[model samples]
Target: MTTTATPLALADVALRLRPGDHVAVATRELRRGTQVALPAADGGLVVTLPLTVPRGHKLAVRAAGAGEPVLKYGQSIGRATRDIAPGDHVHSHNLGMDDADRAYEFGTARVALPPAAVERTFRGYRRADGRWGTRNYIGIVTSVNCSASTARLIADQFRGRVLDAYPHVDGVVALTHDTGCGLVPTSDGAQVTRRTLRGYASHPNMAGLLVVGLGCEMLPVDGLLDGLALAPGTPVRRLVIQETGGIRATVRAGVAAIEEMLPAIDALRREEAPASALVLGLNCGGSDGYSGITANPALGRASDLLVAQGGTSVLAETPEVFGAEHLLLRRAVSREVGQRLLDRLDWWKGYTAAGGGTMDNNPSPGNKAGGLTTILEKSLGAVAKAGTAELVAVKEYAEPVTERGLVFMDTPGYDPVSVTGIVAGGATVVVFTTGRGSVLGCKPSPSIKVATNTETYERMREDMDLDAGRIVTGTATVEEIGEELFERVLAVASGEQTVSEELDLGSDEFVPWQLGAVT
Candidate 1:
């Protein structure tokens, strides 16, 4: 919008919007006294109304008209739901897009990707069964809270010994959580527990795994095995802290077991494999106005390329995609996938409402500070992280994504919880986009951080790996960045260290979603 202020007005010059946008996310901090230009009839429709909006507050998107609702993201982020005047700030009080069991226009928005995938390859650790890995580590997974420390001690034994011995074996990691005990064996918690435990034990990235548990826990080690379809005790090793005599005895025996397993684990080597075997996880956090315009679309391009190569990718953060669900439904491969996605969304609405949270609670304070004002706006930008691939399947949270194409997994918008579900669902690599800077990682599966802008990347050089912000800076196009992201994924999958790995991140981020009543 054109400004009327004198020749040299330069106060917190934030995003100056044009007529097409509905909301403006704060790229820079805004103070109460900040003066901005408003839409004037004489200046024509190109002028966007401006107000002195605080960092996370919404301002009137020009006085609303009787039939005119404030638009966000160049689309109907929501509606006025009531007559509004121009220059009146818009927010939850005035606008509402309470979508309930809404049907979407599908097959109308399918983006035809460029003919085929670019020829790209990476040095990946090819498994005996031909699966590829970003890192080869021995997982010491705890099935009960009692064995948590024991698992840590077992993993710690190989931390920093003068080791030319197990160079190929990445550091052993203990995957533990606070649950897995104190629950009914037939309950959902038990089922969730079993799924998570088995997902790790048989995860493609783990070269070998040692299942640890306290024999007396309700969700005992043997019960967990019954739920999984593994060949036998041959592929994995197990230890019960109690049966091994004591902590000291268990640690000693665990070390011996790992010593025996290391040589065999090290025997696996990297080789050529089809990119289709790759299952990419689409994630976004610390977003900004530039996220959708830059990194997200770029990620979409990369996703489509992967799908074309016969690979699979998953788009998660279900609540984050609330407003943009229609966009995806339009691209659903079948009506069933679309309906299943809608069913999950319906469940979330009821669940959130019963919990006293409105959909408006979706856009985090950080998201609002970044220019997203409503769930609709935030969702639109968030889905961009998936890139434009066909909507093949939509699974419940943490459900393994076996379909070899682009799919969506239902998850809460929280970064760690969402990524954990994706990882647990069998994604070996994650490509996360950030504009405000999210320092995150998911191990066993390596994450590649792509910065949406040069500024954030420069500010946190040590944390971000690729500068997807280059797209906004004009250093590269989304296609180029997408290609770069694809290459980086393969590199990380093949064992190249992501920035998070190099900095020893991802260790504390192994949080599995605990889905049970807090009783």
Candidate 2:
């Protein structure tokens, strides 16, 4: 399962990421005594394998003393735990993240990309607030977990062929979550939830909205709309189960209300819009060793292209980008933006410490099996999705995205929470890259999945929208794949259905980051 195929030549046995990298990644399984030849540009060193190594695993190319830093992607991923000889497998057993810090510099490596030669456009719904949306959905937003069932019941009434006449309307989606009542109104948890709900209710993708609530909850339906701003004529309705004679009555009222609004929603039509209208959300999950090598960097290239066209691309999952924050800070447009990112990381250090954990506690079990050994390693790969665009802005979780180039949002490394914050920030289209096959979808926005390796691409063809694995197999270059992905983003923005949308898989992912104590 780890290797694509055994190579006949020693040079193809493993890949050296950078000229000075201490280790090389095994492209295929190599048995003991196999001789791996490095290219002339990489010093032309040849090492004999002392034991079998799985594909995606790393192997030392040169001898190193104990405590010496192990380098990958031209950066220190960690330190060697003990004296390591050439041809030895480099992994958790022999590496540690101790003493990984270095001098931090701000705005040193900033380089602006030239504008695209041609303008690109997509068909989208232009809202009254001057935003363009990739999809037109009618959302039933819940104020608390108490009203989740009722909201779903109401949305269920329009399931299947029920919306056959409303072709313009994508579908009715119930945005529900697990918390609403326990936390005090002023708590960070309560405020975060409220901000998320308001964002969803006002998202340009939502042509119509229905707010459903259980009257007794601390987070009431009325308060959820405090700062909401929707299209000038968008249809909206609210229902409280307790006041509307409970669940049965609320469902009937909600269904009737939506039925009345479908015609107007369906009347809205798509028009050609500039690509600058796009707000792209970037994320990665189930990552493997080829993630940075293939999909993520390709996505980063595409992000750079979008930025050239004057669009916004957001990268999230703060903890996932831990050790690599310096790379981003160096690209920050100003010291303030760089400092903002540092502040978020400092907060995370305290956040994890309070919970008796450390930043290095990532590279989850799945990540390790996929050949990632530490958070430093994972972060190095994860940041590749942002491309080389300037770090224009840094936003808090679920905060609206206002900048027009590459931006970073502070969020947990967990997929659902991270993506939820991005979508709530007004991302009309999301590009999610996965190395180990994740089928996550985000409603009110379409998710285009990119597979990192050929083996995983072939095994999970049904879920992946694009095969970035072509880069690893030598059939395509990163720029070619990046341009292809950029076109696909426009296609999806113009209403092309993604595999996740076809399977109806995004309704259960509306999880908001819950913080603070419940009182």
Candidate 3:
């Protein structure tokens, strides 16, 4: 594989990701009549473009018959819907999803890797349950939307400098969602919401929890507590707006409860913890053609490094992995783990069909503009974030990630909802990659943003934390940037604030995945 610097001269410039790849990505716009070189395998073949190719778009290196598979990264991205000539721009206009079943072989590629040569540690708070936390905060969780405002009001009371006296406490945060009531208690939506709230309440990052509820809501505080199975003497407080007379009285009572717990919460301190205590969440949004070639693979390398240190990393967004699930299945640690991933894919297929939608509906307008043509192309790129580690486990939405190394979590493509599930599943830090520049943050856990292209990185320098774009510039290799990202993770876990945290951007991004009917 060869990497090229960005803004290549329009005269003649293209990058073939792999020797067997059938298409070359245009590093710059290619105008009609411009000639570009193809892979050497074609014996010095050169193709003259018949149409203008946008920057980051793909151009066919050889003619492909209709219904033939188009290759990128040495893998099938999709099939050609119509005959594609050499130099033809390959996109949604000519490319379509391939419905052929993939042959899945469990554990065929599961190779054990040696441990890291260097021992690394970060300062973190070790919880009594044995989990470690990168942040220390008091969480106010709302059981129902009716109580959301009260929870926010209580948190607002301590937002700015009110916690200045409490040196160890991060701050008071209110985790409020839109749906909690107007649904049957036995419904899937209610159960998902309940599980999500309980996960946050018991998260290691939280020093104390205040579960607020509307007295008559379907999902009450008692039900959530029961479901979570919290042991006696858990550092939790509960309040009901209706039972406490009204919002005003409830807010006051909540404030008083937090005041009473502040001293004990602040008593917690950070200590040196091994890298095994870290759980990293991998996510990407606003992706472009460069995402797969640059940021995603670099993040994958970093994830592998963390796994080598006995830490855990999670890759999510189920819909985004639709066409590329076979790649992951081959790395599964067991037949059961591989089957579980396939099962999720089947469920999604049926779920989308029932909803009159399809997986190909992805690659939003922004994605197409950035050179991603279909869901298949996006999935192929998205899975690169998992690196080449063995797939240790597959988990449901909001389910706790107990296994170390690489794990998969079922979640939507929506960034906020996906990260929320990851955070609830016990991710202490999140790494997000983007080509179109997404400003996203997750509280309790710090987020690091990586830009896929130099242009996007330079344009959104304040929002992005790292530039994997250096890989495209040939200034750095994937492994080099991966190592740098690993070090940044440790530093952030040790209390260095990320750009997202500095912008105070996590408060509004805590949106949990809601399933089932609202009524």
Candidate 4:
């Protein structure tokens, strides 16, 4: 079962992510009885498949008794529910979730990264509040769903030619969500809504902002301002439809306010800034088996590079990182940081249970169809986006990320919601990894989409910003691709438009994490 040969070629069409992994991923559909060549330390070994193995699916590389641990990435992804022979398809049918004991030692593997060779800088807007922004846009924020349409109409007026004179200001964007009404103002949901709105209203990327409201909703413009503590003299305007006489009147008023502020917003200019000013949001969605093997790890390397440069990277999606939290705990800067992460996990366990769901109830239908068997397998891959940096701090959802290195924010696994929290936390740039081809974008912060495999990258080239699939195809190494991504991040931060931004994809993706009953 072992050999001393060099690792198999990337062209072999199959891969074992780690030396101790008992299962290997199929790069392409494997037919029954087909001999698959597996690289071993001593020499090459061949296994004949007993069943068809679809692309991205796993094949058992060694025999496992019923209830035995199934190993991948050199870690136990799950346990076998039935005896599995070598070459058998390993999936949900024969695999089941199990809670295994993990050794949680804080700061055991913490290492200070060496500074990068090149001192990189990007052109960014330096705000008076001492925050750097990649984009200078006028944000029109709605306090309640009742004013969502009015906000859109106001922004629509400036959509194309209206903002032609304001060359320094990015297009006006209306950030509207479905909540903000139909819930008690004192409830958790209301607090979350208000906090999220406040974050956007005072975001660094917004040179100026206009708050729109229907006047009587539980979440009001004035209430949001009261909680936000916005600095005096900051450029902000407010309008309420109920107070402005009606919808048309409010739209006109909102447009007038933005017009009055345009000259000042357009006065802001981009200046050269160090990479330390960059706060990158690490995200992944529509993931598949190739995720861990390719894009996620490559993104992790890029994150490590960012940390080396004194920049901050934020890894989110709390439930998505459930089973893999132990790996992060070991990198925690202190016991307190590790405990904070564990606290969030404990909260999620109760949150999901109370909803009659389990943490393993993930790997959405799309994930399963893409060959992900369980949340454990997905989580191990998802955390790769964090790289190996020490976890400096863990913050609650929508909280600003103050630490300079890698940090984690507690957020739901949903792409839109998770990214929204990240952007609200002051991320000026985002690198999103995806295997199933997600066309997502976020305003204020531009999003860079990386595809995990060549097929998806080619199919979605119009939307994907980079191709990490080259790592899997042997065209490039992880470090090389990571360096390439790092360069791209700087370019995007320096006023280059991303594919998503060019396509105007961020308008509908603004969703805040709602935590209480909707009623």
Against the unseen true structure, what C-alpha lDDT does each candidate score?
0.74, 0.90, 0.88, 0.88
Any runs in candidate 1 off by more than 4 Å, and if so which? 1-19, 23-63, 66-68, 80-103, 111-119, 161-164, 227-235
Error of 1 at 302 (Å): 1.3
Q: What is the TM-score of each candidate against the true structure?
A: 0.87, 0.97, 0.95, 0.96
Candidate 4 CA-lDDT value: 0.88
227-263 in candidate 3: lDDT tens per residue? Answer: 5644334478899888998999999999999999999
Q: Which RMSD does model 3 reach against the true structure? A: 3.2
lDDT of 4 at 99: 85
How far does residue 307 in candidate 2 sit from its true spot (Å)? 0.6
Which prediction has more favorable lDDT, 2 or 4? 2
lDDT of 2 by residue, 411-464 (tens): 998998999999999999999999889999999899999999888989999999
Error of 4 at 88 (Å): 1.3
Better of 1 and 4 by TM-score: 4
* Local error of candidate 1 at residue 23 (angstroms): 4.5
Candidate 1 on 1-519: residue-level lDDT in tens?
A: 344453212112333234655444333434434444444432323223444444323444344544454665556667666765433445555676644444587667777555463655666767655566767778888888789889888877787763368788777888888888877777776777677777767777888778888998887888766656442333577899889898999999888888888887777677766677888889999886677767888898888788887788999988888878888999888788898988998888898899898766876777656655568767877787677777889987778788988889988888988888888888989999997899998878888898887888999999998888776445799899988888777777767888888876775787777766643
Model 4: how far is 498 from its true place, Å? 0.6
lDDT of 2: 0.90
Question: TM-score of predicted model 4?
Answer: 0.96
